[model samples]
Target: MVRAAMESGELAQVAVDVTAEGTDKLFTYLVPRSLAGRLTPGQWVRVPFGGRRLVGLYVGPAERPPEGVALKEIAGLLPDIPPIPAPLVQLARWTADRYLSTFPAALRLLLPTEARRQEVRTLTITNYRLNVDDVEALVSELRRRAPRQAELLAYMARVGGEAERAQVLADLGESIAGPIRVALEKGWLTAGRVARRRDPFADEHVEPAPPPVLTPEQEQALASIRQELIAPPAFRQPVLVHGVTGSGKTELYLRAIALVREMGKNAICLVPEISLTPQMIQRFRARFGGDVAVLHSALSAGERFDEWQRIRRGEVSIVVGARSAVFAPFENVGLIIIDEEHEQSYKQEAPPPAYHAREVAAERARLEGALLVLGSATPALESFHLAQTGVYRLVSLGHRIDNRPLPPVTLVDMREELRAGNRSIFSRALVEALDQTLSAREQAILFLNRRGYNTFIMCRSCGGAIQCVHCAVALTYHLGDDHLACHYCGYTAPVPSVCPSCGSDKIRHLGAGTERVEQELQRLYPHVRVARMDVDTTRRKGAHAAILKRFADHEVDVLVGTQMITKGLDFPGVTLVGVVLADTSLNLPDFRAAERTFQLVTQVAGRAGRGDRPGRVIVQTYQPDHAALQAAAEHDYHRFFAEEIRFRQELDYPPFAHMIHLVISGEDEAAVAATAQNVHRVLAEGGFGGQILGPAPAPLAKLRGKYRYHLVLKGPDVRAMAAEVKACFAAARGKWRASRSVSLSVDVDPVSIL
Candidate 1:
């Protein structure tokens, strides 16, 4: 077939990995005889382009080359890495089209970071195995002549007749290298290279946990998911497991994965954050053991490559990881579960193809006929709306396991505390609760969504807040470093003795963060042990696990953290949870602020009373009677969603309309604004009938030294709007005068406008 095809002038359409605009489409290439029969769609290959070699993905055959253009032959297929599955190739195309991204960008998401760069390979080490039938006899015979060789053979035999070269050298010293070579030459031992996987969890020991008896609600949820797994419909409706916190949603995921394995298919479990991966991995490992593989951004490049290899080679039946794991290259996927399906971390914010893992997972499931389970205590309004509209099968786990009641919540009005002459950051109720909880020898969790020592430093004389040089946001004061830092751009500066605005020593640290809360707790309770978890403290690798371990071991009496500790954490020692300020997220400019506040408050509250003791939560907020805060205090998601959904419907927010956010940014504010206007005009004039809301400054007007202007296009069908936007941009690219100085980014179904 290869020779015949070569003679017949066969052509292959290759999507080169270059990111340039015009290179987004496939280029025709000649199929060399060397790769003719071996080539397949989705295989990564090297090809020549304009006197340079570039990596490209084979996108199947082309009937003919463009009329008069010359085609180049593929250099060779990428070695070691396995070809991407055909289903994934199709899924990538769909993602590219739906997300308004280039083909290469969407394709790149399916590959490991180092694998795409060809910078990593399977690590291998040499091993020596005893070739002699009787190792004891040989050792005794050589003991007199070659003592080192004899000792090496004896050691190898004791360790099951084989040992890695590195281990042997370390044990017997490098002096045994000559002996090992001599032994191999004399036919006394055999040496061969064995693949050594760089497992990220190699240092941790996970004990196998037996499956617990399922509650009736859990059983029903599992049955619904299992039914979909056993026999899926032509257009399968995803299973939405709307379980309250502590309702055993994870158990249902585990059982469904087990069922899929029994049916000879694989499973992918996605968590929202890397902080959650450790606990989720431990649980999955405890249930599935070595059959599980984890993939996430936190893993080293080598570990990621090895794990990808394991998944590609079909060595792992279950994959548990963060957002990108939705593209886990499992060929026959039977299930994909998005744990904490409402997390915004599941959405990619930068670079092109800003896809949400939930959307990608749903598409992948549809493509491969896999069952998608979206499990969340508070589902995203969009997902819950889909469930309500019959697009998804809703399974509810309304009660906690063992009939444990949801934690009782206390709403503390901070205004009353201020009126009562309290100047401290903590309210009287929270301070009292902490004292009682500490006296009772129980643990507590203080939840604050912010992470700095102070929210901002303001000059009392000028009433101006210190702001980031590159961004419009205020700079946070870090007490530990004695510096002011911009969380958005990571720019740091020394804390000035005098206010820059007024030239006066009247700078006041206003608003408390996690760091300040920790300090205040230590000052109030001198003997209390506290641990803080947030982006600041957990920036180093494995820091999250370390802080969590200390809290779990009861070495720390209280854990103070930002939103990182809000979900997927199961600490049984915690009997008290204090929401330092529930209004932090509630006051954000984003429309999802109310919903986010409800989720955060409810999730952090669920952390309490997970053990045998009844739990209590004290939420300190100025707006104690706010619907979101009240609903969260009562553990009533339905009430929050009911009111929130009405607001969304009235305002035409998500679940009622799909929005395409276009942000034009540059160093020159005028150019950016001009480009945004041009984009708006093009959309309005190019046959788009949707509402174009803005050519105004973005909520985050300036970030990382760039001025941003955005436009929001709202329509009923996203695909049609995306098509119109793409075509309009392509046609208007040359007409805009500021096109060269500014850049435009399109986000389909943006999680946050900021």
Candidate 2:
């Protein structure tokens, strides 16, 4: 059968699933005539490769097989599926070329894992809707002969004339299935089936909300964005909406989406974190109702697949989710809004593409001739620089919505607190504010970037701290299980009672995390309800939404969390926000540390005083006088940008010069270090005029059992520098492949150097 199929003249260009460097290209395969029309480009198909059947994307009809090469027949066609939208295919290609990622890796972005296979177990509603006229008579007759049947009929009637069989069983128990069977047999209830989606949020309840009256500032911003939406289908500049925190940026986004929808076009709204998706989606769903579809990492595979299909079918006009939602299948996208655009979370750190969603969204909008709106309390330097250079239009909302005041921030010097004999994690001002907020029946939020119970465990006798064996980082102490775990490598071990290096038992857990702060809050305010929102606490699906919902309903008086709770969350009841440690991220080796610190402080501060009452923030830091903290405390963005941009310019980082970060890693330290130096030499010898730095050990010198080294190239033009770097990498590819242990990865426009 295979020989006969191969002889047939049907051929397809298939993008195999393998993601290795050399194996990223498309291969020609013989397609059976029966599956020719059925299998379209962008549809998943099974193909024989290397003696195994691998799932691959059918990339379109192939021209012809190579001259003397054997063409293997396609193994099978994947189930009922639509071709991935053409725009997405182009975007994926663009992403692959620009980010130095494999085409297959970028293709995987559009195809969810569950969607590779056809058919899913969807729940169908079987059982009748009430025959209203005969219901009373049938019930009257059946009540005498069978009480269970009568009871089933009565229960069905109470549930609004229709119910799924599963719902019926759940409400009445399995024993009631017998009565339901009898009722169906007697024609008392009809049997039917309706396919139901395996929705992850099926258990979650969301109430539709009417759009609010836009503030004057928001109205002006929305009008500008709407104008862009209706503009000519040519290359248009992006619009940067530099709104202050609590300035109704979201309201502007909502109104812009409405305008786009009115034009019969779709929109993609992106938040930076999964924790922010539920609230953002809820808000979008409330305004747009059924027009909203969600995409994020936390969703179950089936839920993601169903949502992707719905989007492709044009069942939804709006997509709201984390970074990946930027690739949503919208045939005619009219608007692309990226909320909290400055966040580093928008950059994919783990994989080859390392693409930034904001960058992708900008290009996508450009290709679709859609209006791109970037909203942020702290915009990235590169984005704001573009606005300043007239490449993007800039709009600003200087005041909070409803004329609410920006929260007054107080920076406490923890050094002073220590000298004054106060050693608690919370400053006196923060404690007092918490007391006042709780007394007023209002809510508060305590933020710490760190998670786990303690930062690290150290023995006072030997001054030795416990660290992860695999990674260069310290092991964090988790509270409940009394174990130490590495955040970078997932390495875990039981906490040592004594220092491993010394024979003394004077070990103590130091530094406060969300867990420690949570424990402290409970101890300090025993009667107040508190909730913790962090990766550990919110690992389960819908946990972010659940925790925020509880806080919104005033079920939680204090919400303690990591950076996840910082952006795009609004709660009028939250009157006070406490920064347990403001200097945690200030001292990282990365140059963007100050920018990140300023953004976090400003963003979390914005979360307060969003309600009717004025809000307050207390920032406790060992270095209260630092420029970033001071600028954040004063709510002075311009000042911070001015100072930070100067330093960035002087240091030749980001806006001043484009950067490409190269990392070489392997189990053998010598091989990895040697490979990194060799690659640097290749670039230098290629006459690339860019400033080359590193071949230095990475901040995380060792991670997940691999020795790591880093190199950076900085140049005035990103495109030119990228081309040169690509050429240099190509020139050295052979040597790298021949080497036994080293591997190289490149990240262009890297978010962080460390």
Candidate 3:
């Protein structure tokens, strides 16, 4: 029998573009009647076009070729690449165009990178239960076999068990697959297939992950989100979670997502997964169970493909993962909760598109009628703007669920501390707070945004600071390694006792960081068990979770950390928070600095007094008059938002208006500069009624060898702005392609164009 049918016909032409532009500039292709078994809709195929063989991603059989075009049958079917469903193809098309990504480009990129090959075994089970009739049939068949084989079957019947393929193979000693196939072919067995995934949560009960009992505040937040998700008629709405630090926003997500699943709809959660440990995944899994699909860059190609398939098939009821998980393939997406929505990690900085996960998820929810709950204690300015305008409903769990009063925040100016001649890492006020909290049997947290041992390696005589050789940045001092390292470029060097240029042994380190603060806290309070969390310490898979768990379990009396301490981690015992450096992010060159500073201080302040012990925060900063510090100390988000929005409106920034940044990058600095200039000129000439600033270098311009130049396109008309930028891109496309290293990115309604 000829199993493969023949759709024999003349070669047809199909245009396929695998680039980001997603152009399906149709090329000619033949339909192989002989390969009818393989020639299916959305099957991947290679083709000969324009003097070269290209991977002509199949879009389906074509009716005819254009005049003067030669056609060829799909050069050959990519047998391993799975067929893409027609509807998904449309969705991909829609996303590509909507996001201003090229259509065919988006489609090709959407396919699993390892789809062509590389399916390997981890481990899985095929469950089966034999009926009485089946057992009887098996016994009869065995009785007809040789005595030993018959005895084996009789033993199986008596045991009333299903044998693993490996066990059967070992028992048979040879050709186990054949016998299993024969038994199935002879209708003597039943089978159910299952696939193994990398679920580390299944193991490791030494530290169990379970949802904590929700406090009243947490319950209120969850109840609000639940109502939004279950609202009748299912109109799309954005719910801003304004819970302060340690307010159990994540716990609310667990409950809301669980409710979403219980309603027979899928829920997708986006976290900075690559930035988290296995223990975090375990927590999500422990609460969500096997129905939760964890997707991130850590998984193998095959694993990602399998997980993506599970999402596409709606086999997984919930997905907990990172930035790109916003694209999880669930048609009936009921809820999307983006935790830590304000963190810059939610933005894909390295990629050309530079998309923020929160924006993407919100946009998707708008399209899918899914309830979008942005769970952030430090809500981004964009979200705050939306909430203020009533575009998004603001729902806050204000007080810590423990019903503890808001932490008392006090700022200690470093200038005063320095003037007082006490150069210790801890300020007098902070030390006093820590002692008081510890005496009360409550935990204290000291936060230093910097992660290194010190601010920099400096020559005392010449006052020269060590800098990264490759980057325009100072090297950070690491006491543990006696090393000077660049945070941006990963450049490292041994600390020099004698300054190389000065030839002096007088080398001094200035400024304190997490490592220094942890050292000082332990030295000053020898009896207290202290744990430090920072980028350096939390690099391990379960480090953050382990530290958080230890702190929650009261294994650690004091937790000294960096900014991670601020992002929602609910603990029942923390009572004191010391901001070792409150002005770190506050002093950035960007206008958003005030907003970031305000969020950071308030967030860390909210972290303390979350337990029943009445948490308090002591902020040490040089600028006591800073508005952000003042507003934060007052726990005044509304005042902060108003002032920040006023600044934004004065500057004609987003929310008040619309802003889009057209970023151009290339190895050729001259070329990028030219492109940026041309784009600026185009926007200026387009008669746009708004700001057209900077055909100039961006913040941290030279990154990873790419000379980046940005053309800031701002206007009141968002649609006009987008169209103008699109025109600018279309004009620059030639220049972009001419340079292999050159790239372009468009960010619409960007939260922080930087």
- How high is each candidate's TM-score? 0.97, 0.92, 0.82
Two-way lDDT contest, 2 vs 3, winner: 2
Per-candidate clashes come to 0, 0, 10
Q: Which segments of model 2 are wrong by more than 4 Å?
A: 2-8, 37-39, 117-194, 204-207, 274-277, 686-689, 737-739
Q: Write the per-residue lDDT of candidate 2 for residues 1-754, one digit (tens) a residue.
A: 6566666667899988887668878899888866756766677788888877777888888887878878888888665457787788889988988887888888878776566544443345565665546667777887888888888888888897788887888888899989877777766677787767767667666788888888788888887786777678574668999999888888888888888888999989898774365667677767877777888888777688788878888998888888889988779999999988988889988766889998899889878888889989899988998998898889999998778899899999999999989989987888888889899999999999999999999889988788888888889999967789899889999978778988799998898788889999999999999899998988887678789889888899999999988977888888899989988999898899999999999989988988788899999999988999999999998899899989998988889898889999998898888888788788898777899998899999999999899989899987788778777767776575326778888898998887
Report the lDDT tens digits of candidate 3 across residue range 348-399: 5543344567766766776667898887766888888888788888888776
Ranking by lDDT: 1, 2, 3
Q: Compare the candidates by lDDT and give the number of the best one.
A: 1
Each prediction's RMSD over C-alphas, in Å, is 1.9, 3.3, 5.4
How well does candidate 3 score on lDDT at residue 58?
65
Of the two candidates 2 and 3, the one with more favorable TM-score, higher being better, is 2
Judged by TM-score, which candidate is best? Answer: 1
Question: Which segments of candidate 1 are over 4 A away from where they belong?
Answer: 1-8, 274-277, 737-739
Least well predicted 10-residue stretch by lDDT in candidate 3 = 1-10
lDDT of each: 0.89, 0.84, 0.71
